[model samples]
Target: MPTLLVTASPHRDEALGNRLARQIAARKGGDLLVRDLAAEPLPPLTVDYARALTLRDPLPRSNATLELSERLIEELESTDRLIIATPMHNFGMPAALKLWVDYVLRIHRTFAPTPQGKVGLLAARPTLVIVSSGGFHRAGESKQPNFLTPHLEAVLSTLGIRAPEFVYLEGLVGRRATPEAMIAEAVAVLGDAWY
Candidate 1:
């Protein structure tokens, strides 16, 4: 499968989420496209880009922002599977990942606005989200609110990605478990899901 791996962690080599995503991609064994958001951060949305989406006319590709948006959408559309590895930043998505989301969630390109509501235009695909956090944030066990998962779910659903699977590596700062142990558990969980 053609896998698109989008990683947003600033930790680089030490990011467990990114490491796990890479391992999953390797196991899937296909053409891998890695978008390291920290290494190459996307620009924040400009007023022109926002206005372009609202226009009834086709978006002008001549605009640099629109061009980048189109390219990001194309990457998402071409992927057979998508893996997003990110660290939860202050109970929500990091700036880089949110920027990527802004670019990909185009008005006429990825979704259509209807009288009832916005409708997704893209096909649903296999998507996995790997989220890391310094504290526990898994439903009932959460010590704090988790805005990241809900936001991502809604955003991906808007782009026609239904029920994307999520894996969490929490309590890294608290050291509830060693990094190796946590990763092994996560890997085992994934293997079980696939097999």
Candidate 2:
């Protein structure tokens, strides 16, 4: 069976997106993996980090962090599907999730440089991202999406994953859209075929 990994922070206590992610995992018929970035905690990318990763040498830091990074990558490589339940924090993703991305996108691992251009090392896979926000900000409406949608797409594309399907649940606090309504929308959108 394939696996679905949902990375996010549950600080808001909003399980709508997370519940939808679980449904997707069930549809995929895989071992569901949920890694709360806030709980697991990934460090920010740094110069030493790049050096250590490129050289395949251990960094003079917490071994646990490095091991978690390795484990995350291994899980990604093995999984057939991925679902990202992300909440927009200050118009972008939480810092923890960004750190998780940094850890997985290693040089010569998730991607490699080619003579023509950078080539993706990961196999093409299906990814469903459920993004929740408190306001409406479509592509042309906002500038901050660059750090959220495009960043994920670029990294996933670099790893050979393409055509990611993202479900945007906007205006949860306003527009009279309660958490229940948002969750219902997500669940309906994810349907049985999504995974």
Candidate 3:
């Protein structure tokens, strides 16, 4: 199976999310395509781009503004499975990852607007999200509200991805357990179901 691994971590070496994603990809054993958003960040959407998306006419393949969006959508369409590895920023997802989401969640391309709501056009696939946070965000132990998971779940659902499995590496800042230890434990749990 083809795997699309999208990583959004500023820290290259010490990022637990990225490490766990790579481990998951290795265990899955498939053609891996990595999109490191931190290394190659996407530009913010422009007004022209926004207008173009609302047009009834088809978007030209040569349009420079929509080129990246097109490519991102193509990657999502071609992948058998999708993995997003990101660090929570300000209790939410990183801006880079959010930009990626904006690019892929194109109207009339990935989804269709309906009277009821939005309907997804893309085929559903197994989606795994590896989130690394400095503090606890789980329901009972949370010191802060987690806007990342719910936002991602809603955004990805617009593209037909349902019930994405999330593996969180929480309490990485002040916790007694080492980050490495937390990552190892998370990986062990994932191993039981990821295969």
Candidate 4:
């Protein structure tokens, strides 16, 4: 099976999610492709790209905007399992990661609009979302609004990926939290899942 690692943490060594994603990918043992959004940010969604995907008539072959979107689509379609490593930023996804998501979830490439509603085109698979936050964002202890998991789940599910496995590393910001301990806990969780 083909596996794609989508990493978006600005933190290189310290980013817990990115490290966990790498560990998971290494253990899973399949064809691997890594897209590091922080290293190479994708172009934000533009009108030209949207026109290429949604136009009534086909656009010219030489349009660079369409080409960019097409490349992004190919990356998404070819993956069997997807691991998204992201740090929750200001209660949501980082700008680079959000842009990458926008690029992949194209109109015709990932979904089709029906009379009833939007339907997903891609095949369903196991999507692992590794999230690290400075504060707690889980059930009763959340100090922040978590748009990260919900937004990511909704977007990926819209493209036919369902029930993403969420692994969270939290409480790194407060006085009492140790990032190393949090990382150890997160790694233990990963060993239980997708190993």
| Top candidate by TM-score | 1
Pick the winner on TM-score between candidates 1 and 2.
1
Cα lDDT tens digits for candidate 4, 31-149? 98888888887766667667777688766666776677678778878888889888889999989888887777878678888898778898887789988787888889976689988
Off by over 4 Å in 2: 44-48, 54-65, 139-146, 187-192
lDDT minimum window of 10 residues, candidate 4: 172-181
* Candidate 3 accuracy as lDDT: 0.87
Full-model lDDT, candidate 1: 0.87
TM-score of 3: 0.92
Tell me the tens digit of each residue's lDDT in model 1 across 20-83: 8888888879799988899998988887788798767756566889889989988888888899
**How do the residues 1-86 of candidate 2 rate in per-residue lDDT, one tens digit apiece?**
57656658565334556666775677567577667775667666666666677676657776554676688888888788778888
Worst 10 residues of 3 by lDDT: 56-65
Candidates, ranked, lDDT: 1, 3, 4, 2
Count steric clashes of candidate 4: 0
TM-score of every candidate? 0.93, 0.81, 0.92, 0.89
Stretches of candidate 4 exceeding 4 Å from the true structure: 174-180, 188-193
Q: Candidates 1 and 4: which is better by lDDT?
A: 1
